[model samples]
Target: MTPPPGPPPLPELHWLEQLIERGHPHLQAREMRRIHVPGGPSFPVHAITLGNPDPALPAVGYFGGVHGLERIGAEVVIAFLQNIVTRLAWDTGLHRLLEQVRLVFMPIVNPGGMWAATRANPRGVDLMRNAPIDARERVPYLLGGQRLSAGLPWYRGRLGDPLEAESQALCELVQAELLGRPFSIALDCHSGFGISDRLWFPFAHTREPMPHLAEVQVLKTLFDQSHSHHPYIIEPQSAQYLAHGDLWDHLYLQACENTGRTFLPLTLEMGSWLWVKKNPRQLFSRKGIFNPQIGHRQQRVLRRHLALLDFLARAASSHERWRPPSDDRAQHHAQALAQWFPT
Candidate 1:
């Protein structure tokens, strides 16, 4: 029997466009375009802003698909936009919350990878590992027992620099809009591994937490409160479990350090055992079919993710404070999610 086809391109694009059009009037929207690898596709990064662009109102930026095969991340982002549109149409509280803070959504960062269904760019550079950081001492483990080198799958690329066109484009966008700004939090989504859902912070080179560790802990707490089913595991910057050259490291440590702003970058790793196809090569083959069990689970997880994002956006917009920082212990233990969803 012939296998079922994977998600089509037109339906995804059409759904995104419709969501934006319907929600544009309720939120501030901008079209940011970037050229993919030279002589490649021209990708559009949509920036949606809700509420006034006030410095006091903390902003939340959501991006996904830094790697191509991680299409579930992109789907979650689109789902997020659709959920917001639906809420705006029926929920008054949601419309008011959206109008209080800005939420910038870049659904797909690596369009080239999206097309190829590969992690690296067409030129063979891993954008995640291409950040301008020293990855020589920190190597990522591949599927096999062998460790990845600089030119391999998880390669840091061309002397720890951003050589890929998509990487360069993302860096430029960060500098122009996100960096040197007063955004309190940012989330980048990805899917792989059936490990527990995790909230990863910065500093890939060392295990030390970011200077704003207390604040990050607070935010993690808030996230935990938002969901009862999917528990969130918050860890230090450099855990022994994963190593080196992550985009969050570049953003939170490098960019925020240079700009002197406290931008807490969180890497949300969605469990992939739910939606990922077993035989990835089959996805490209005509006889390949999507695993229904995984897809359904992914859809459910996507809804939970959207709800968490909405809660975070609302908390940031209102500048809600969690438990009173009476002492260092109370302050450190207080998660930001609690502030977002006060009980």
Candidate 2:
């Protein structure tokens, strides 16, 4: 019998296809949706799953490349998957860890944009800003999100329309895979801004603290204690700026409907300014600003975030042990307010 067709021609997708081919039997990859670009061949948005499939098990959803220019974001997630797939051969410990966790990866979420070298998808919509939710407060002219023109950045798409195909695909995946469980964590990676790495939580549409602020505090505490010298600035997305139609914000708000479910969505905004500062020539290249052009720097960036990704997986697995106790929830809440909502 003949084998299925290979991934479409693209470096990131090609690498992912290779991993899927190599890691077969140990992992499963499905094309969530096929994205077609104008005057170009279609590309598949694949979702790779590993570990337990039990609804009772906690899950972690790792997403990247929501913006096509942020190739580094997709690379980081791909690197982590490569590490896990290779280790599954000999890492008995990881095998045990998988028994209690469900891992979902959608490494290249916006392939059309990546192919065209634009931040927006082929339809010109920004997937990250393509959700249905609107900002409670006034957002910046165009950066926050706009319906003015798809030609402008951060386009949210026309009002009263269904979500863009990519946005709908992501929401469907999260709802089916992550929201049904008792607890789940999502880490969506992106770059192309700032000078320092940042870990942001929800409420990108508002400045108000999320319902799970206390739980966020506990996770932050665990991360700090375990990786004492970690160089991430953990805070709410609103701390930097509020935006309209953040997909995570939409999913997070939806997750709140199930009072028993705990869904903590995080955005890893890796600062690209550091890369540009080290090599100013990147300023002129569209992709260079969002991705590490230097081979060594790309490797270093991948190495730096692998631990954090692994930490989230372990944290989700052992959540019963480290998640804040009922007796301490109030204290954690108070502390969270003081730390992230300082007056």
Candidate 3:
């Protein structure tokens, strides 16, 4: 008798597992949740931590695969992790850096979606749009998140329901590993939106600038001073378009509720349009639209973003040196408001 074929495997998970094996004694991998795909085998969502574990130390988080189609995002993160692991044997500076800063990696957040080749998980919820937050201002129909049906893109989970397991797991990890610290940053990677790479901060639910706008401006200034030729368009997520149930927005708000915590959550939206423009045939393929289909381009993409990731680690570790003082906070806030909130 002929047996039914099984669902395709998740290559990202395999690659991450390999890294865990090689990073032994330096890396710590924890299973956040086990996702069972309907008619498919279950896959584990992992959170890999390294560096300082003390609550007093600053931390940075690297996340990817929020949308399963954006394989390039996950690849970029994995490449950076691999680079770090390879350097563990001889990088004294890295060991020194680890003494002061903690690092977290959840390179593949939607393993089921990656396995199923869909944006949403097997439960059909868009994890990014599955948070409890809602947009106060008008948002574009459907693109901003909709409750019409799970069949649609950007579908928020059912009203009045708790978050999906994946969403809950991510939140739990962030709250415990990041929010408790005095300073921390999160970079969630995604692609397939525009023609240029973008580094977006919170308030995707509205155009209102967040309280940390001044800090963001300072971070941008620091990034520009360091990487003069970088291509990212650093701005608020609402500057592009507002969306409902943004997980970062919810998490950032939660961080704000604490009296002295500073959490800067960023979204790395790697534009796929340029890739499609360079190779127009990519438009015909669904995966290609969200990823670099060509080999050299993929390698270039992986190589280019590693610097940004490293910069984030360095920035978090030395935040005390560069963070704006009370005397300059108002000036930065004024400039930021003028730049992003011009009426």
TM-score each candidate. Answer: 0.77, 0.97, 0.97
Residue pairs with backbone atoms closer than 3 Å in model 1 (clashes): 51-99, 218-335, 218-336, 219-336, 222-337, 222-338, 274-294
Kindly list the per-residue Cα lDDT of model 2 for residues 149-210, writing each as its tens digit.
Answer: 98889988999889877787788889989999999999999997699999999989999999
Candidate lDDT values, in order: 0.62, 0.92, 0.92
Off by over 4 Å in 3: 1-8
Enumerate residue pairs that collide in model 3: none
lDDT per residue (tens digit) for residues 1-343 in model 1: 9735886442445566678788868766666645455565445555565555665556777777787767767778889878777777689876676566767777777766676667766666677767665543534465211224634677556554435666666666565555655555677787774646666677565644456666666666666676656566666535534455566677666555654455777777765544334434444543122211345565777776776667668756754465224476455744532432235
Assess candidate 2 and give its TM-score to the true structure: 0.97
Q: Where is model 3 poorest over a 10-residue stretch in terms of lDDT?
A: 2-11
Judge candidate 2 at residue 169 and give its lDDT: 77
Q: How many residue pairs collide in each prediction? A: 7, 0, 0
